[model samples]
Target: MDQEASYGFAPTEFEERVARAQRLMGQHRLDGLLLTSMDNIRYFIGVDSTFWESYTRPWFVLIPATGAPLAIIPEIGRAIIEKTWVKEIRSWPSPRPEDEGTSLVVEAISGLPRRHGRVGAELG
Candidate 1:
């Protein structure tokens, strides 16, 4: 696939939407959000090209109020995740852990400035 054109599909209005979502998040009193579902993450970040390869790695994205969002993905996605919007990507090599790498997700959520932390999670 031509990343050039396909990726540009949603990047145009992504920033504005992100701002809008952030505002909505604030109004809803959410400290931040953890995105684990592919659809939801794509909706928020405007990039929808994560598919599992030989490995069954889970994909998750975290959007915080103050800083850039983070991407927690399977090792197979390392290249694109790094090359893509989320420069900060936490990876899990296969042989999938029984815990399913929730620890990293939790840690990322923990790092959020949750003083008034009403966190939003996409549990799909």
Candidate 2:
């Protein structure tokens, strides 16, 4: 591979993953999937970041049942995520624990065509 090639999974790989996830969501009657962890976020968007190590910051990738994945992340990650196949990116100022993107996330979820009124999430 040439040095110019980007890192992480290929664009097509991410597309397929999102497609499969959407299919599963359809079967499960979920309106969307809210991915918060680094692994799950990276899996869909192919964005790897060391900043995820900071316990203070949280990143998200919301995969809707009918469209491309939307990345709700800190503004610092905008540059990195822009390099990926994800087109819809929403970012908030970092270290704002008072809000910490909670509103943005809720707004994104609220706009989805929620037939089942369900959104899948990765919970420990």
Candidate 3:
């Protein structure tokens, strides 16, 4: 590994984890997976940036029922999150419980036309 690549994750690792998750989704009849935890998102998207600063901030990932993962990050963290090959991205600002980035997620799901799909969330 080169010095610049020392802290970064690889794309192959990302793809493998996503394939595994998709398989799990199929097995569980889950529409998709929501990742609010750091490691889980990294495993799926290969973004290994610092995330401890996000507790007061809203941070999560929405893996759509039909496409790649989309990250819901703070406005300031968008640039770093975008470095991942996972192109889908949405941002939310702090000091607002409204979570505007949520709408982007909603639109994606609404466009799915999956009227009766089960949303298996791991938020508990």
Candidate 4:
């Protein structure tokens, strides 16, 4: 079975969702979106995993204004994230209190077109 088939959503569906989100972002004059919640990540990238139950590592996904979504996650979830629609996957060793995925998140955000840009985050 193919990855998408197993995930229960076609790649096109994921692309459509990204397009819709980008359209909304543009309309709102938002530069990008930073998603930290597991549900939000799954909705954008089709990454379904129970590993999120472990709080040792944090996962994030960044959707730029005009390009593909980026996944900044732990090395443990690399394989699963790879199977998702997202192509840019940045990973690091988890449970590292010193850094964790903070550097990667910064790097991803810095790549956005605008400096000191308005990024929407899921707060709830």
Q: Write the per-residue lDDT of candidate 3 for residues 1-124, one digit (tens) a residue.
A: 6523542556676666777886777787777777877777666666677753557675677775556877777787788777776777777665466764567667755555353486556665
| Clash totals, every prediction | 0, 0, 0, 0
Model 4 Cα lDDT, one tens digit per residue, 10-99: 988998999999999998888899998888888888778987767778889999888999999889999998788888899988878998
Candidates in order, TM-scores: namely 0.78, 0.92, 0.76, 0.92
lDDT of 2 by residue, 1-124 (tens): 7422553677678888999999999999999999999888877777788977787778888999998889888898889888888889999999898987889999999999979999999988
Model 1 earns a TM-score of: 0.78
- What candidate 3 gets wrong by more than 4 Å, as runs, is 1-7, 113-116
Instruction: Give the C-alpha lDDT of model 1.
Output: 0.70
Candidate 1 ranges with C-alpha deviation above 4 Å? 1-6, 10-12, 50-56
lDDT of each: 0.70, 0.86, 0.68, 0.86
When 3 and 4 are scored with lDDT, the better candidate is: 4
Error of 4 at 100 (Å): 1.4
